[model samples]
Every structure is written in C-alpha cells, then in structure tokens.
Target: MPDLAQSTFILPQDATLTSEQSALEQRIWAFINDNHNTTSTHLLIISGDAGAGKSVVLDAAFAQLQKAARATSGELAGTDNKLLVNHNEMLKIYKEIAGTKSYFRKKDFMKPTPFINAYRKAGKRADVVLIDEGHLLLTMPDPYNKFRGHNQLADILQLARVVVLVFDFHQLVKLKSFWTPALLKRVTRDYAVTHYHLTEQMRVGDAAVNDWIDHFVRGKMLPLPHPQHFDFQVFSDGQPMYDLIQRRDAETGLSRMVATADYPFTVLGGKTWYVQAGSLRLPWDKINFTDRPWAQRPETLHEVGSIYTIQGFDLNYAGVILGPSLGYDPSKDRLTVDLAQYQDKEAFKKRPDLADTTDAKAAIIMNAINILLKRAKHGLYLYAADPALRQRLLQLAK
Candidate 1:
C-alpha cells in the first residue's frame, strides 16, 4: 500500500502590492469615497489563477480601507465603507451573528443573506464594499428573493460608490456561470478593470515544484529548480505512491502520519478514504451526500480518480490512483485533457480560446499534486498500484 505522512496547514501571508497597485488601490478608494455625489455605480473585479496572491492583494487593499476609514472617521462623505472576507474566517463571523438570532443557527450561516444585509445596513456611511470571495455569492442556492438579480449582491455593489469582488475564478469553477464566456466578456467590458498577472512563484517553497506547476499549467513553463534536496518519480503503477506514504523514518518527522479535518472524508491506505459516489457535490453539502453508498457506482472502482475531491486542497503524501477517465496512458508518457469533468464545464467551454490549452489542465492537476506534495516537509513518496507503473516509478527514482 502507498504511504504518505499527514500534511500541515499553510497559513498564507499578506501579499504586498507594488507602487502601481498602490495607485490603483488609491484611485479605487477615491472613487468609492467620491461616490455619494457621482451617483454612478463602480465594480472592481480582481481575477487571477489560484495561488497567485489574489487574497494577499485584497488584504492589502482592505488594510488601506481600514486606515482610510480611521483617518476620515469612517464617513467617506458619500461612500459606504464595508469589508467582508470569505474563506473560513467569514464563516466564523457569520456563525457568531447567527447565534444571536432564534431562527439563524451555525448551519444557516451558509445562506449568508440575512447576515450580509444586516452588515450592509449597519455600515451605511461606508462608500466602499469589498467581498473577498465574492464568487460564492453567485453560487449560493438560497430561496430568499433578496439575493435575486438586481436585488442581489449586485445591488450592494450599486449602493456603494466602489465595490470590489476579489476572487480567483479558477476556485469558483464548481459554481455555475463562474467562468462562462459571457461572464468573461462582462468582466472585461464592465468597470475600470485591472489585470494583475502574478508571474512570481512564492507559495511553493521549492523552485522545481514551482517550475513543475507552471509547466503543468502552461506546458511552456521553464524549470527553475532550487538547490534543495528533492526527488520526483513518475510511475506507471499507482501502488508505489501508497507505499511511499506509509514509509516511516522516526528520526525525521518523515515517520508515516495520517491527517484528518473537522470535515468528512477519511484518509486510509495512502489514499482519501471516503464513501464512493457516482458524482461529486457543489459546496460542503455536496461531499456529504455523494459519500452515500446508495448512490450509483461506476463499472470501475478507483478512489483517487476525481480531481474535484483532490483539487484546491492538499495531503501530506498522495498516492494518486490515475484512472482511465483522466486518460492516463503509461506507454505514451503523456496526459490527455478532458473538459467534461470540469466543475463548470459549460463555463469553461464558453471560453473557447482556452479550449485547447493543455497547460491549463496540466497546471490544475500539477497544482493539486503540488498542494499534496508540499504537505510533506521531509519527503514525498510516489506510488502506483499497477506493477508496471510501480516499476517505472522505481526506475524513475534512480
């Protein structure tokens, strides 16, 4: 069996914006502050690939907003000043608010309309409204009419002189209409949008890892290996990866370990140990339902085949059981792209220019693997169940 130690948590640092970015932030802030008189709506949508420091830039911008708010005494003349961060922290804040109400509970916070409206109403004097994970607003399946079309979160954007939706559309792929061509056109056409393509690699500590991710995403990516001790093995089989994860060396934290989240899904036998299902879920609830055994099963039984469960998250050492669905052809030593499995295939198809971008697909998988690999501070063990693939990995190791 493949073995990999449990991975550790990565606390992202605040990204520092350059002077040019500072100017843009200042301009956006000024527009927000001046909105009361302008009566014109302003929307600023920030898009980037995952791990491109999108959150860091937003954090910096929000920090500026806080400073400006304190300096101007929170009254931006005609602007309504507000800042909302998504991710785990936003959920926590919502939970606290839900606790005060009889009808609202911790679980109800996922439908964040009540909490959002309340926050907006209280911060009327504010001119700028920022939603870090604004994409989530679009995906929310709430029956509440307030979240509809113009009355929806877009209304809040209209209310504020300046509204910022800081997001990586890549992460929102699970949502419908996330990266649709029409939506892409709207983003490019509407508002004074600024495209900040972060070319630097900071998240991955190793240069090879960074280079590999770039190469995987956009095949043209050049390697920039670090001098650090590291090894990469490509296997024809899937079992060896599992064996590596299970390998333990007590001297180093390299000893085998297993990690679990407060969320569901158990890691067993060097692969994600979760109940099987025919399809995956959308948000948190999706995983809960899909894990039900009563759900239809595919002709073949392989656990690590789904990228939806694997992407955007990491494990200490991953024994990825490359399934046929992903078009893993060992003889060719090349991977094929399949858009059907995409979280938002319709949206992806709408962006026809990206239709042939193999880099984008590889980058997604490589990045997911990177997330899993980085979880190992010591070493990563590669394994494949197929004996030929396992032997290939062993040969690659040498």
Candidate 2:
C-alpha cells in the first residue's frame, strides 16, 4: 500500500489568474467555504478548450484557498485536501513550476481504487479534492487497480465533500475515460453542481493558426489560407523537417517532433525503436517519467514525441507526422482515417468500448492527431507518411 498522505503539492509557476479565472476561483472558493462544514457534497466543473488556461487558473485558485485556510483558520483549516491528476509527467511539471510552496496532498487518479480503500480502512474521507485534467480519469480496472469500480468519477465523489474538476472534453483521448459532461451531470445529480467556462486563447501565439487548428480538429477540411505571423509549414522530406525542429529548438527553446501512434514501438536494450520514413530515421524519445522528464530534458529534442508525452505542455515548434492511419483524399478533398492501419494497441484495445463502428474509431484517431497538432505555441511543422496527405498539405501551403 502506497502512502497517499505522504505527498507534497507544488503550485504551478506563473500563478497569475486572469479576470475570468479569478471569477471562477471565487465561485469555487465560496462553494468550499460554504459547504466545508455541511454534511452535503458539492461538485464544481471548470470547462475549457485546450490552452484556455484551466491548469493555471486551478493552480492559482488552490494556492489562494490554501493560504486562506491558514490565515483565518476557517473551515478549510486542517482539512486534508488532495490534488489528483492522471499523469505523472503533468505532476512533475507542476512541481517544477511551483518550486517549494506546499499546496495539498497529491495523488494519481489512476490509483483511486487503492486510495479510496485506504481511506475507508482509515475511516476518513478527504474534505476537498481538486482533480486536474479530469477528462483523463479512467473508469475501467487495469493492472494498477485490483479493486472494482464502474466509474472513477463516482468513486471520487464518494471520497470527498467538495470536488473540483478542471477538464476539457476534447482532451479525453484515452479509451477508458468516463468523464463526459453527460456522465458527470448524471453522476453528480444529487450534489450541488456549478459550471464555469474558460474561453481565452493563452497558449498558441497566433489566433488565426489556433482557429485553423480548431477547424481542422472538428473535421472541417477547408483549405487554410496562409497566415502572416504563424510559422506553419509542410515538408515533403523528413530530414529537413527534423533539421528545422532542431534549429528552432536551439534558438527559441522548446521544439519537438510529435506524431500519431502509427508505427509499432519496440524497446531494444532500453532504446525505443527508431521512427523511419524512407532514409530519414530518428530514434523515438525514451519513455522518461522520473529523473529526467520528457518535456524538460534537452536530449528529448533528438527524438519523436507522442500525444501522451506532450499533451499538457506547450512547445515553441511542433513537427507533426500524420502517419499511415490518417490520409488526405485528393478526389474528396477531405481527411481520412484508416482504422486498420492505426498502430496504437492500447487505444485500439478499448475500441470495442469506445466505438462500435469503424467510423467511430477513425474519429478517435483524428482526435488524437488533433491534440498533437495543437501543441505548438508559435509554429507548426508537418510531414505526413501518407503520400496523398503530404501532397494535399503541400498544395494547401501554396
């Protein structure tokens, strides 16, 4: 049994809150303050699209709440609040950003069953639980969880009085995710539910590029008119694309090559299989979670990244590879997904539960690709393994 109580919470860097974020924070705070002593549970859902500053807002708000708890010795005082997240990389990033400030107890949402069991054994429940990236919450039992549960959200609700979930619907890329808005509403029907929407574009540097990314992800195949400020481009060759990413990384800081999980991955002597496209072969990034994280480590620049590794963070330049799974049909002038060629075994394993039909599987793949496409802050570089898609992108570039 892992010690759930022996964790430290770090506030994210650049903890400044926007006006909209501040308003949402106040609402959540008011709910926590009002319901801390009550026998009733409350649920607050903060909804936003990617780069809408959900994490920043939530981090800042939690810090303030913790401070208030200490100053006035209110209802939150001595309360065992926990910050829950699905990814370890994301937690590490939060710790890096926060430095030394203590926020709350932190735990992975995937291990909820164990945590809940421990709490039940101890005869206690957390007063407040803040779930970051709540969309990644898993419902199915995996190797890590031996306890039975139908939905993670329901289990979490049983463990905390005031549950704060910060999530984006589009970010639910995993097959086992059961945190849909409809499901959330259904599960939290008895609790006091409050919703807040964040709409500002904070990550992407170019608004036009961001709009194009939105339309692209939504299956709108309209040709993108070239933007003046954004450094978006398509490469016919993979070597030059990799070189460009390297140059950008050296100059402007974070730049990475991200691709859909199209190729088969194999670990040979602790090294990931090299991604190959004709003569351009590059080693895929090592699966670094602890010691050296994927985003912060400089050596990761030499390898390719996936949606899982780079989703929550922003990069200066993103070199995107649309693998064989996704293609462009010149005749139809539309993007197409080949479910048969999709190589992400874990994602495909959950296909039966996530999507019953072929079309549904394709849509899921497109969503994954969309996440990779939107990771770039100032620039987007592209290379499609499918020849037709490559040609189509080149045409659009012209």
Candidate 3:
C-alpha cells in the first residue's frame, strides 16, 4: 500500500501552481465567479485514461475550494464544496487522509448516492461538487448499490450549481455504470460546458513502455518495449511471475499479482475460489473488511487481485495473469477477446442502449486489462494463460 500511499500524497497547493500548470484552473474559477441563477449546471468534464492525474487534479481543486469556503469575506466566502467519488475503497482512502488534516472533514468526502439523496431531501444545492472517478457513477437505477436515481451524474448536476467531474470512459467496467461520449453529450446537451483531457501520465512514467501497453490494450500486439529503467517481464508460467512479484514486494512493498476476469468466482458463496495457472494457485482477493485497501493488506499477497481491487490504485509492481478470455493472433499480430470465455457476468449486465452487442463487452474486458496493466508504477510482469498468447508475447520480448 505504500506504493499507493506514495502516489496519493497531496502535491503543491493550487495557489503555488505555475501559469503553465493550471490548465483546468481558469475555467474552474470562471464557473465559480460567473454563477448568476444557472438554469442548467455549469459542467466541467475532465477526461483521461487511468494514471492521467485526474484524481490528483480533483484533490487540488477541492483543497482550494475548501479554503475558499473557509474564507472570512468575499464573493467565495462561506460557500459549500463537497467531493464525491463512486468507489468505496477510494472513498475510504480519502476519509483516511482527511483524518490527519484539521481543516478537512470526513463528511465533506462522500459517496454520490447519499449526497444526492440528502440534497434532494433537504431541497438544497451544493456550490461546487467535484466528483472523482465519475465514470463509476451509476447510469441506471440499482437498489442493491443504493442508487435509485435514473442516473447519478444527472442527479448530481441538478443538485449542484457547478459539477466538476474527473472521468475516463475506458474505466467503465459494470453495466450499471455504462457510459459513452455520445451518452455524456446527451446528458450535458443543455449545460454550459467546459472540458479537458489530461494527457500527462503520472503512474506509468515510461512513455515507450506505456505506448506498448496502449497498443496491446487496443488489440495491436507489438514488440514489448526495451526501456532500460522500467522492468517488463513476460512469463511463460505463472509461478515464476508470482515469485518475482513477491521479491519486488519484499523489496518495496505494495507490488501485487492480479488477473483478468477469465475465471469463475461468486460473491458471498461461503466457499473460497481459486485462480490457477501451471503450479501457480491463489485465491481471489477476499471481500476486504479491514480499513486497509485490498492492496494495502499484508494477507493479500496470497490472493489474486481483480480490477475491482486494483483500479485507481498504483502498485510498485504488477504481476498480471492474462486469463483465458484473451488470445494472441500471431497472423493478425494482435490480441483477441472471447466474450463467452469471460467470467465476470456482472460486467455484461443488460444496458438498454447497448443491447446484446458483444462490442461493448469486448471493450469492457480490454479496458479491465488496460487498467490492470497500468497499475504498476515501477514495473509490469505479464503471464498469459493462453499458450498462443504467452508464446506470442514472449517472442515479441526477444
């Protein structure tokens, strides 16, 4: 977890940011200053793939916002600002960070559903609501998740004068949170809009290696990068990959082994489930109850991580098992996904707009791998379960 903790440390204050650094600052302030009976919410949608510093930007914005809210006198004085994120593990981390700061409070960081429900019930609106990981916001009603609204973002927009969302559509994993640019445009059709795409990658700092991962995620299997500083290993077997991950963890902690959703496991089934590959056997990460995140816990070394556990968190190193749903096409020189082989049925739940098309399903699967592969800040170790994929990847490394 030190790997993640190292990344989450708050950076320089916005007040100290250089003129060249504040790309989103001017627009953020304009919306705050130009508020005069906004019939439609002023929408600031910031998009980036994972590791693009969206969360860090949102955190900096929130810091400045809270300071403004605490100001003695001004147009911005005594204004309310709340930060929201749909992911529970991330929410917990935010709260933990708040615990150390006197000015920050846990109540200020909240899940979207409760924030929306409370505001609607009280007939009030927030001044500025910054949503981190906004892509995880529910697109449809889900009682199990306690989100009964038709759409969470739409609801938040109604409940806030200005909504700043840190989003990445590629991070969409579940059908409940299915989103596309078209859908986003439809949602904000009438809003006064400002948008930004963060291109600077923060976690995976090696650009060449990062590009190689990007190509693979998009189905173009190219030669693995040969960056002298970044470690990229292709394992023909799983056990050796696991061993390397352990060594890396022992050296620097917070390195992990994760897998694609190509194996079967049920939530709350009263039975332990395992992910096995050639002498490498480990249980799926159990439902975490402790305050620590799945990656932070010491016991998780024996458990294989999932997209749910690893997303939005950085690792010192990541040992990834590309499960059976994926194959390498040596002839096509790319990756292929078999939706039928994917075990995460929850991700393929019905979406009215998407219907039964496998395109969305395939993209979701690839996106999961993309997020998994990007979690490592220092290195990435890969093991493909499909023999053809393993061989192809190994050949490319040579």
Per-candidate TM equals 0.54, 0.89, 0.93
Q: Residue 358 deviation, candidate 3, in Å?
A: 1.2
Better of 2 and 3 by TM-score: 3
Q: Best by lDDT, which number? A: 3
Each candidate: what lDDT? 0.41, 0.72, 0.83
Write the number of the candidate with greater TM-score, choosing between 1 and 2: 2
Over the stretch 211-265, how does candidate 1's per-residue lDDT look in tens digits?
Answer: 5544543323232333366444454433444345445332332222221111243
- Give the least accurate 10-residue stretch of model 2, judged by summed lDDT: 1-10
Error of 3 at 199 (Å): 1.3
**Using lDDT as the measure, what is the rank order of every candidate, best first?**
3, 2, 1
- True lDDT of residue 39, candidate 3: 55
Task: Give the Cα error of residue 206 in candidate 3, in Å.
Answer: 1.0
Q: By TM-score, who's the top model here?
A: 3
What pairs collide in candidate 2? none
Candidate 3 wrong stretches, greater than 4 Å: 1-4, 7-22, 25-30, 36-39
